[model samples]
Target: MKVILVFLLALGINLVFAYLLALGFFYVAEYFFGVCLTVKEVFFLWVFLLVVAPLIKLKFRSEE
Candidate 1:
């Protein structure tokens, strides 16, 4: 149960990060270039977050 909860929490955190990053890009692009992200761009950001977030989590854990 603890393991499952931790996994769920990590997944949730990654989703939130991906969403925020996507939204950030949306606004930045609109402001600078008058464009929006394509679906592919959003999907790539989400996948990139999934790959990055766990490594960051582990790095912080090892520092403790």
Candidate 2:
């Protein structure tokens, strides 16, 4: 039960962090490029990074 509670907490924190990160990215992109992205786009980009980053780490690790 304790482990499950920790896992849930971690997941909630991760989601909030990802959302804020995405919002920051959205504003930065707009500031630099004048291209406005929707919340859906930002959310998808955030999730994509979360999925791809670990794969990239594994690939680099294997190459070493």
* lDDT top scorer: 1
Candidate 1 ranges beyond 4 A from true positions: 54-64
TM-score per candidate: 0.67, 0.67
Query: Which lDDT tens digits does candidate 1 get at residues 1-64?
Result: 9999999997898888667776787788888999877889878976887678678678989999
Displacement of residue 47 (Cα, Å) in model 1 is 1.6
lDDT of each: 0.81, 0.77
Cα RMSDs, all models: 3.0, 4.0
* Collision pairs in model 1: none
Residue pairs with backbone atoms closer than 3 Å in model 2 (clashes): none
True lDDT of residue 44, candidate 1: 90
Residues 1-64 of candidate 2 have per-residue lDDT tens digits of 9999998986676566566667788989999989999878987988975655546557888999
TM-score of 2: 0.67
**Clash numbers, per candidate:** 0, 0
